[model samples]
Structures are given as structure tokens and as C-alpha cells.
Target: MIKARDALTKIKPYVPGKPIEEVKRELGLDDVIKLASNENPYGPSKKALEIIDSYLTNLNLYPDGRAFELKTALSNYYQVQEEEIIVGNGSDEVIKLLSEAYLNPGDNIVQADVTFSEYEFGALLMGAKVKKVPLKDFTHDLEAFYNYIDDNTKLIYICNPNNPTGTMVTEVELIEFLEKIPKGVLVVLDEAYAEYVADTSYPNSLGLINKYPLVVLRTFSKIYGLAGLRVGFGIAQKEIIANLEKAREPFNVNLLGQVAAVRALDDKEHLEYSFRENAKARESFYQECQKRDIKYVKSHTNFVLMQVEDADTIFNKMLKKGVIVRSGSVFGLNRFIRVTLGSIEQMQRFWQVFDEIGG
Candidate 1:
């Protein structure tokens, strides 16, 4: 038998929601609506499909290692220097690269206890410790996060509009937290669902890059509707980007992803369309929760976390009904369930099944 690193001892496998095809196959259902992963219900933009179709004939050739064209497009879009960006297979890879670059056996990362699991997974991969801060009022407690920092801390993660809960910290609180952090600690503002946020008070993470040693990560997977293509990028100072680039694999993002992402960035109409529709659907979900007198966390992301009785049972029941949602046990909150807000017809079907089953 081979010996693995001690770090593997502390890690648990990351569980994703059941896929639509698998559910359909197992349950023998023709129509399966998945609100489990916060994916865009409308699917990819037409422009991205056109771009991908053009690139399909060139599959035999290796992708451009530098990703020069996509990087240039992102530079122009975000008003940042080309050298200030690092694109990855997904934002998940960049997080792993950061951990590889900075974390050591004793170094630690600080994040909310119930936020994104990737932070802990990345840290543990490099044998780094994790200090988990409890969320106050179902949102990131900035004060508590500040207090958790110490000399051994190497990275800090704030998943704005955090996963599972979908709640966020305001702009003022974020600025204050960034201002007081000790030098040398890298802060990652994970805004995976930033496009769904309708709140004007959400922090402008890009504007703070010049002032702090941090990275702003955004994904094409959410509102951009390109999750299957697997493209996400990070914005930071040139120096931070340089360090991360050293650890990035060549052609980490495929040819199709680069083309699709560039095309997606240019399609503002598609972006806004998904945004407006998601906002409308999310509100309807909120109203349904209200009408049913169910307690739910106000969400800036596309998912809502609702406290329920026997979440695992309700989760299985929803799955059996061909409407798949996430059970809160995946996030350490066994009495709650997280449901993604989807299209009006999808949401209506979900609620119809849920109404019958009684969550």
C-alpha cells in the first residue's frame, strides 16, 4: 500500500447535486427540473454557441497556452491591465493555485464556517489549517472574521452572497474589514453570483484591488450560463496575478471556453436578460415563501435557504418528485434546504410538487 499525505486525513469528499440525466434515468421521469445547482435556467447565449461552432473544426490543435485573446477581452471589459488577470479551468483552480503558492503545513486560511467548501478543500490540499468563524444572523460576521486573524493566517475568503445561505455583507462593512487587515494576508472576494445581486449596497470588489492585496473571482458559470464550459477568472494586482500564473497549468482553459467566454462577455443583452428574469423569478419564490408563512433568508444570489423540518427527508422527497434541490446536511445545517430560483414554469412545477409533499 502507498502512503498518502497526512492532509487527506482531514478532508471529506465534495458532494455535488444530482445531475438531471442521472435523475431522469433512475426515476424514469421524462421531465426533471433541477434547481439544485444555481445554474442559469435559460441555457447559454446564442453568441457563445456561434463562437463555439466556429472553433469546433480546430479541435485537433492545442489551445493557445497564454489565452491571449480572452485575456485581452477581459482586460478591456473589467478596465484592468492584461497582466492583472489569471484565467483558470474554473475559479476553483485559481483557489487551488493560490493555496499552492502561499499555504504551508502550519499556515491557515480563515472563512465562514458554513460558506463555500472549496476554501477548506484548497487549504487542506496544501496541508494548511482552517479557522472557521461562525456566521452571525445567517450572514458573514465581519467583526468575527477580523478577530480570527493571527500571524499564521495566510488567506481570507469572503464569499459575497455566500453559497447555501445566499446572504451578503454590505459595502461599508467590507471596506472596513479590508482596511484593517494586516499586511501579507491575501483576501479573496468570491463573487460567484455577483450578477444576480440586485442590491446597490453590494461591495464593488474590483475597486478595492488597488488598495488591498486581494483577488476578485468571478465565473462564467452562473449568469453567463457557461458552467459546462468551465471558465472563471481572477482580478488582482499584477504582482498577485504573476504569483498565481507561476502555478497555472498551460492551456488550463480549453479553446471552446476561451471563445465562448469572450463571446459571452460581449453579449450584454444576454447578460441583462438573464439578470432581469432571475430577479423576477426570485421575487416570485420570495412571495411564495411569504404566502406559505415559511421562514427564509433574503437572498442576493439565485438560491434561497429555507429552514425546514427533516431536511434530508424533504430532499429525498423532492428528488422522488423530479424536482431536485440541495439538502442542508451538505452544508452542516441539517434542518434547512437550499433551493435555486429558476424559470417561472420550472419554479411553478417545483412548488406544485413541494406543495403536495409538504416541506
Candidate 2:
């Protein structure tokens, strides 16, 4: 019998949140709420839906491989050169592209232990080794990250407002870390939830593109509520962008995604509304945790990572109660869970059920 490469053994697949329909059917219940996966609970901006509806007729044609119009829009929005932008099916594609383009077997990728799992996934696909550095106090320890880099280190992933922890590395610390890293090593700063950051100290990662050989990734999946549409992009130096583009499929991003993302960028009102609601919900949730004496990391982004004894049990209980949050076991934090801050009403409902369970 044929067998796969040895590296396949190192790869653990990503398990996303179950669909609400699947959950309801399994539990035989109705009115399920999913706060898992950090999806925007407000749903997509109306303008995005309207534009996508208008573009439905064009679905028969292949999407623009270059994604020129969307890239142009992104360039104007971020004040970056058009050549520096590359659109993807989502940031997941971008991550895969970076690994494919840069990593060689036996090379190394580095990230905090309990952060987004994709960085290690990308490494394993390319037969590279992952050096897991433990986070400091639920945040990325910039010093440890820099210390881990060596001649064999090809990639270092910084998930700002990190997944499962909902904590961030500040701008000053990131700038210093970037400066200290070797020029040959690529820094992929995955700012997937950046739009929800209310903190003034989070690095403006795009600004670093011109100064260093860094790639800053963003997604419409979060605040723009386009996760279902699968739109995300990366900003890097022209040389680095060219390398990643080589690994990209001819039409990785679909027609609907381009249309939706363009309209979503223009919907400033929707953007502001989502940000405001997320900030408020984050505060309220923190207060709830405080009152209950539940330990949680203070978040600048749209989610909270709270410690509960037997998170698996609490997660199962919440599921049965028609609410769903992410168990942190996937990120190697078995005692914690990540809850996405949703609309005021949805958040209130989540807390209500949570109180009942914890009480």
C-alpha cells in the first residue's frame, strides 16, 4: 500500500465550528446561536449584498485572475501600491501561498503555542518544522519570538489580537521585533480581526511594508461579515508579492467575493457600526466575567478568551442550551474558550445562558 509523506503525520487538520443546521439536527433543537469562529453577527453590510446581487449575472464568466479592480480599491484604501496587493480566496490561501513559495523541507516556522493553528499547518504542508513558543500572560512574547529565529527559520507568524487568547502585541514591541529579526526571514502579521481593535497601540502593520520585508494580511471575513464569501488580501513588498502570486491559482478569488469586498470597503457606516458594537460587547462581557470571578484576557479585538474549569463541559452545556462558543482545546488551551462579541441582543442572550450554566 502507498503511504503519504512523513510530514503528513505532523499535520493536524483544522476543525471549524459545526454549522448551526448540523448542531440543531444532532441535538434535535431549534434556535441555535453560533458565537464560534468569530463571525460578524451583524451579517454582511446591505451595500455588499446589493452589489453582489447586481453581479449575479456575471457568475457564468471566470473571475479576473489579477483582481485588478479590487486591488485598486485596496491600494487607495491603504495608500499602498497596486503591485503590493494580492487577493486570495481568503487569508487562508494567502498563508498557503506564502508557505508554498518560501518554505523548503527542514526549514522552520515559528508562532505562539496557543495561537491560530494555520501557521503550523502551512509549515507541515511544506515539510517544515514548527517551533512553538509559549505565550506570556496570554499575549505573544515578542522577546521569545525573536529569540526563536535562527538561520533555518523561514517564517514567523504574529497573529495580532491572537486567536483563543484575544490578546495582542503592541506597536512598539512589534516594531522592535521586526527590526531585530534577520532580513531573510519573512514576518507574516495576520491581522485578521484588526477592524475590531479599539486599542490605540495595535501596530499599523501596513505602514511597515515599505520599511521591512513583512507581509500584512487582512480579511473581509470579520467586521465586513463576508466570511461566507471568502475574501481576504495581503500587502507586501513588490518582490514578495510577485513570489506569492506565482503560487496562486489562476482564479483563486471568485466574482462574488470581489464584488462584495469592494462594496463592503465603501460601507463606512456599516464598518463603524460593527466596531462600536464589538467594543461595547467586549466591555460588557469583561464585566460579566469580572462579576463571576472568571479569569479572562482583556481584548482589544472582537472576542474574549475566558478561563472556566472544564471548558469542554461548559462548551457542551452551552451547545445543548442553543448557544455555541469555541472550545480552546484546538489551540492547546484546554481550560479556556473563545467567545466572539456579537450584537448587543445576541451577546446578552449568550451571557444569560452562560450565567445559568455557571450558576
The residue-by-residue lDDT of candidate 2 on 156-238, one tens digit each, is 99999788788888899999998889978999999998988877898988888989889999999999999998989999999
TM-score for model 2?
Answer: 0.98
Name the regions of candidate 1 deviating beyond 4 angstroms: none
Segments in model 2 whose C-alpha atoms lie over 4 Å from true places: none
Which prediction has the highest TM-score against the true structure?
A: 1
| Reference-based lDDT, residue 349, model 1 | 90
Model 2 pairs in collision: none
lDDT of 1 by residue, 1-359 (tens): 79999999999998998999999999998889899889999989999999999999999988888989999999999999999999999899888998998999999999998999999999999999999999988999989987899999999999998997999988899999988999989999999999998899999888899988989999999999999999999999999999999999998999999999999999999999999998898788989999998889989988999878888999999999899999999988998999998899999998898899987
Cα lDDT of all candidates, in order?
0.92, 0.90
Ten-residue stretch with the least lDDT total in model 2:
325-334
| Deviation (Å) of 351 in candidate 2 | 2.0
Give the local distance difference test score of model 1. Answer: 0.92
Evaluated at residue 83, the lDDT of candidate 2 is: 91
